[model samples]
Target: MLHFFKNLKIFAKILSLSTLLLLFVIIVAAYSLNQTVLLSDKLKSLSKEEIAFLGVANEVSTLQLEKNIYIERALRLILKRKFNESASFFDGSEPVVNKHNLQLIKKTTEGVQVGLAEIDKLVVNLLSKQWSAKIEKNIVNIREDFNKLKGEIVEFDAKVQAFFAASNISSELIEGEILQLERQQDTIDEHIISLMAGVERLTLDIIQESEQLESSAVKRTVIFTLVSVLVGTCLAFMIAKNIRVNLNKGISVAQQLSSGNLAVSFVANQQQDEVGQLLRELELMSQHFRKVLSKVTESSMHISQLASTLSNNTSDTAKDTEAQQSGIEQIASSITEMVSSIQEVSKNAHVAAESTQHADQQATEGHDIVSGVTESISTLVTSVENTSEVIKQLAKETANVESILDVIGSIAEQTNLLALNAAIEAARAGEQGKGFAVVADEVRSLALRTHESTQQIQTLIRNLQQQASNSVTKMDEGCTYAAETVQRATKAEASLKNIASAVNTINSMNMQIASAAEEQSSVAELINQSVEDISHKTQLNAERTHQISKESHDLSSLAETLQSAVKQFKTN
Candidate 1:
């Protein structure tokens, strides 16, 4: 609408400029024709003026010649005394003479008046006779004056003749001038008429051309306006149609998308403009939406399958784990029992080792005691050798005592011979001699008892020496056995210590194995939990994929609707 107003303004300006140009052309043409008509009128007036001037110069020259002839005839007749004839002849020439005279009189009178007036007041004081006398005397005494007057007359005549001749020439010149003026007048009139006719024709032509130009301008404006409006209308309609189609499609797509459907297809309209590009883009978008929908559907199915597998696997794993846990508990209990048995064995071994150590200590002490006893026995054997030497000396001493007793027996036999002598003497003393014989017999009995006691004492000493030797031999044997026993016990104790160290190593290995088994069980439980979490995540993903598929289906349906709407577009 604004563009239309602007075009209208431009058209008004063009129209005003054209009108101004036409007015200027018409004014200039009218001014040139008016000047031509005025020149033609002035030329005709000048031609009439030339003709009148030629007639007046010819008539004045003829009157001056007739006056000269009449004067000469009257003078000759008067000189001959032919008064009557002269009078008669004068009478006969009267009209001609009078006519000339009158003309002369009139001319002379006008010259006299002008001269008299210039003579100041002297002319007014002079009488008619005086004037006449002045005229006659001047005419008689001044022959030179008369001659000069005659010459003047002649000159006047010559001037008259010259005027007449000039008049003839003027006639001819005026005739020629008149003829030229007439011709010019005729030519001017013809040109004026022609110019007028031309002006009329030009005016008509200009009017027609202006009208045609105005008509053409109006027609061009109208045609241009119409074409513009038509093109604009077509453009507006196409734009409005495109907008309506897009809006309708968009609204339909939105509605379908809100409802959630996923099994629709899209179609695009074809064109060769921006609308076509948009439609192609929309079609591509719809295709992509469909592809996305397909992928979403596939993903949902896969997730469902995965969820089912996870649930089944979790159930199986749980059952197997329970059985394995029970078995592990049994194993743990058995291991606990075994540990207790090992501990008991360790305590028993500790006690046995202590006892062995104690026995070994006692055996070491016994070895030292036996070693001292062997040394004491060795000293006892040396003392036995000394005792045997002492026994040999005592036997030598007893043999000597027996020799003294044999000597005493021989002395007693001699004494018995002496007693026989003494008995003879005692016969004299019969009672004293009987008492001495009885005392000698008692002394012999006492000596026999003492000898038996001394023999028994020597046998008791020999028995004491044999018992000391046997005691020393038994102590030496005890010492040898005690040293051997101590050596054996030390070796046995070292062996037992080595066995205890091996048992501790076995216990350490068992603990490490049990710890590793516990760690394996913990890892298995974590794996089971992870499997369950994976199942839950898969289910969530499936739900999301399903939602996306539904959205895509709705979009595809809307795209199809949009394509259908755009199909109605008009290009022609």
Candidate 2:
């Protein structure tokens, strides 16, 4: 996609970037709105769950109030020896208990769930022991439990009057004072009332929490909307401006390229986009133009100098002979200087060849040493792997030994039980069982010894297990280190091979240099002999010297004309 965008037109690039930014904004807004809707629905559902929880708490409170009332009536009836009525009222509590099965559990909080579970258990426990034939006796046994919260009979009477003042208990009361009954056993009524209050408080807390969370969600939604609008608008504007700025820069660089300003450095955006590609292409083109311009400038200067020198040297026929004589004398000295340079080149090539051969030798040695190290690491890795396997097997064997120890411990306990049974049987047989009793005692001692031995073995096995765990951890570390070392050594070997290949390439290039140097040296010797021969033949070319001088002037003039045309573009 990045490569494809690099070739896109500037207009298309701007459109794509704008579209992408707008799409991002749309996605962000949609997601924020989606989250808002989900949160709203969740809050609404929580409100419903809290209402349901409140209903359940109310049901529990109503059930507890009825139980306390019925228990009081039943106890009073028992006090009156009205057995039939007491039993009927005792049966009345069962329906209240059956109502507990309808738990309102949907979307309930943890606190609500726990409170309801506690209420269920408390109701079941209280119902089990509330009204029985030994109910008074049982209540008396747990009377000390209420001693901490113990109040006076007057206090109990006042609480009872207030309870009767409530509408539910007022209608359900038998025509007797229930204060005496509640005082007779205060703990049951107090515990049930506490549980009812707890359930009510928990439901209220959940409702309040839901309300606060809903408020927080509303605030977050508003803040997110404002922030998205602010950030999205700024980001879109900045991206559009950046594209336009870079496009202008690309146009300026192209204008510079067209104006023969090759010496001016090309400036463009460094982004991986179409404008950046255009800028980079302009930079490359400018560099090529600079190179051609530089060569043309040098050629122009050379041609101008050659033309002036040719025009001066070919002034007339007499001056041409003097010029030819001077040139022959200079060629002999130049040939001698070229011979000296060729010898120096041959010497340098020999030195380079020797250096490359030595480097190749060192590279080969490094390859061998790295290969050896890799092999050593590989061997160590194998040993570590085998040790790891052994350690794993040891761990398995220890587990099996521990299981066997458990079996032995169970067998020891059974043996001890059997020995005691045998001893009792022997004791019951009286005088004839005396010997058998002694044997039972011996067998009991044997079982005790076996139990003690199994314990010792278990302890030893535990120690062995700990040692095996430590050994396995160390072995794993060693295995990992060895594997890493093998990788490093392999990489070193590969690096050495690469170096060896590079050394061989250098050696081959050195050999070619030595060969080329030898060929140049031979050519230089031949050119030296030709220069000497040309100096001797200078007089024989005296008749043709005037024509040659005229031709040289014409050639120099043409070179200057060509050079001026090429020198128009700036190179620096």
Worst 10 residues of 2 by lDDT: 101-110
* Residue-pair clashes per candidate: 1, 0
Look at candidate 2 and tell me the lDDT of residue 169.
28
After TM-score superposition, the amount by which residue 351's alpha carbon in candidate 2 deviates from its true location, in angstroms, is 7.2
lDDT of each: 0.46, 0.66
lDDT of 1 by residue, 36-153 (tens): 4443443333233223322322232233334434433433333333334334323344446445654673464344334323322221222121223333343233223223333443
Write down the TM-score of every candidate.
Answer: 0.21, 0.27
* Runs in model 2 lying further than 4 Å from the true structure: 1-355, 382-386, 425-438, 478-487, 510-572
User: How well is each residue in 1-572 modelled by candidate 2, as lDDT tens digits?
Assistant: 65565555666766866786677667666766776676566556545544554465555445544545554553354345333433332334434432232121111223333445543444344335323334333333333332322233224434544543343222235445555555544554564355345434434554465466557766766776677677667755755676687789888877876787777776444566667777888888888877777777687678767866765565575466666867888977988898889889988998999999999999999999988888888888888888878978988998898899889888988988888998999999999999998988888898899999999998998898889889889988988888888888888889889999999999999989988998898899888888777766665465455666676777677777777776666666
- What is the overall TM-score of model 1 with all chains considered together? 0.21
Once model 1 is optimally superposed onto the true structure by TM-score, how far is the C-alpha of residue 191 displaced, in angstroms? Answer: 3.8
